[model samples]
Target: MLKDLLQTNASFEEELLEEINSLGKIVDFKSNDILIDLNEQIKGMPLLINGAIKILREDYNEGELLLYFLEKGDVCAMTMACCLGKKQSKIRAIAETDGQLIMIPISKMDEWLAKYPSWRKFVFESYNNRLDEMLFAIDNLAFNDMNQRVKNYLLDVATINKGRKIIKTHQEIANELNTSRVVISRILKALENDNILKLHRNEITIL
Candidate 1:
């Protein structure tokens, strides 16, 4: 897996990759597993080799807001931030699918930053990408209506799954969108009425 990942990700120099392989350990997670929770101390940075992880933020009212996903070949900028600043994680990370990752120790973060130009570039790029995703989420919450948001969410799911068929329940969508199940059901019914989609027991087929 490391060899294949290295073929595409040129950010890790051969020497750095050797160091990483020696220091880091391979870890696996099952779907829906909570990898990290709010205010938890981050021990290492997870370099995702396959599968997906969802990043979420919780409100004071116990509501959860979906942030963005870290998929194959992606790194969690929040984890990197916590590792660098020696702080706790402000968001939660949950495995979206069974996957594996290479967990690099926090101690190596600074050494690589100073020693490897490629590593530094990769970190900055990851940060910028995450910032953009957050901004997009903020824009949707602040500006878009519920209907539009739901549609956008479906589109995103379709893209992630690489298909138009979204296999999820209305309640699941509600939880991710931080809304009531009743509201989500109503919106989905409206979409069905408009012939925009076909809703089944727990699946939605986009038209």
Candidate 2:
């Protein structure tokens, strides 16, 4: 899997691949598994080999808001940050599906940074991309109304699932969006009334 995924990337040269294969270990998680909790110590950086992981931020009130997703071939920038800075994670990472990943030790980060130019480039690029995604999330919350947000959220879910039917309850959507279940139900009902979606028990079908 690593060979197929990393071989095409310009950054992963033969030497780098050898190092990664030798130093990294395979890890797996089931769907909905909490890969990392808020304030947990970062042990290593994870390179996703398959499946998806949802990265979330939690507030003081214990509300979780989606930050971004790490899909196949993507790395968790926040994890990299925590590993390099020796800080605890401020966000939560959960497996969106059963997944496999390669874990690279934090101790070798600096050594790899000095030894491989490609590693530095990959890290910086990942950081910048993640920052952009967070900014987009903030913009959606600050600028969009609840209706628009709900609509966008549904669209995102459909895209992620690659299907028109979303198998989730109103309460589940509310929890992820950090909104009240009542609000989500109202918005979903309104969308249903508008012929935009059909909501049934624990499920929603986009129309």
Candidate 3:
């Protein structure tokens, strides 16, 4: 099963896949589980298998906000840098949905890069993709209004979860968008009245 998941990346050769199978372990996670935290010693990188993981950027003054997300066949881009540089984690990772991910030790990452051309290419491409996403997020934060941001956030959530039903609390939405729960509630209600969504206690059904 682990090898199968690794093969999904296609950039991994059979030899590298076997190495990963031997070196990594798959772990199950529940929704809201913290896989990595700010300032923590970097240990291993997680390869998402079957669910969504939200990566958050921490700010002492402004609080945490969603940086991006890791979906199936994705790895946290920052983790690669932290692993290679021997730096502590600057971002926090939380499981947005229950799923399994393969944990590859940081020790093996350098070796893999040196030994496997496919691995090197994969890592570099991941960096490029992540940078693009970060830029898009920054653009959204800079020019988009709160209402538009909230709507975009919901659309992203719906897409990531692969469903129209978004099962998240107002506070959770607020944190993802870096706003107060009261603000999120107000925006959500307005959206609901506008026939954009149907709001339940802790869920929003997109229409």
Candidate 4:
């Protein structure tokens, strides 16, 4: 679901969905499929219909940072990284499970928007919301303490999944918090010892 603001006057969601139905066929993707790649042309915007997708980026010497976790009914076409005129994807969409998506070319989207003002409003709102979130993440990482940042991230994931058996590793967590793996490991170990959490291979169960 879209977790941010919406323009009151526009029924962008409905119009966008209608546009998707008019485009190319729905495609099935397996886990780890690179739905879009960095520096790749913008072929289409995808509406995730089922399963989950992880949006991320990896640094040369550092690991990946989990930008977002998009699920069913979520749209990924409005981000600047994948906007129609962009030459490359700023982030990667990695399928977390067997999933289905509806892909619509950006060109079609532009055409569709021209005919439907609501669709244009919706895309603009969605893009603004994404930008806000990215800025929020950056601000927090730059200012928040490590412990509080980790706690906040865990809380965020817990809210998303309903409970806290989050299937993630220290390295991943570290990346998300923009910290070191060793630091994350140390913090996680402390939490486990305190019975605040339990850790397995790559999963952490909140106690």
Positional deviation of residue 70's Cα in model 3 after best superposition, in angstroms: 0.4
Candidate 3 per-residue C-alpha lDDT over 1-207 given as tens digits, one digit per residue, 9 for 90 to 100: 566665456467779888888888889999989999889998898888889999999777858889898888888789989988989999999998999988899899989989999888888888988999999899999999999989888999899999999999999899888889999999999999999999998999999
Task: Please give the clash total of every predicted structure, in order.
Answer: 0, 0, 0, 0
Q: For candidate 1, lDDT tens digit of each residue in 103-163?
A: 9999999999999998898888889989999999999999999999999889887777678
What lDDT score goes with residue 68 in model 2?
A: 83
Taking all chains together, the TM-score of candidate 1 against the true structure is: 0.94
TM-scores of all candidate predictions against the true structure: 0.94, 0.93, 0.96, 0.78
RMSD of every candidate to native, in Å, equals 1.5, 1.7, 1.2, 4.6
User: Model 3, residue 111: what's the lDDT?
Assistant: 92
- Candidate 4 residue-wise lDDT, 35-67, digit = tens: 876556767777666776877776676566667
Q: TM-score: which is higher, 3 or 4? A: 3
Task: Report the candidate with higher TM-score, 2 versus 4.
Answer: 2
TM-score of 2: 0.93
| Model 1 poorest 10 in a row by lDDT | 1-10
Instruction: Evaluate model 3: give its lDDT.
Output: 0.88
For model 2, state the Cα shift of residue 141 in Å: 0.9
Off by over 4 Å in 1: 6-9
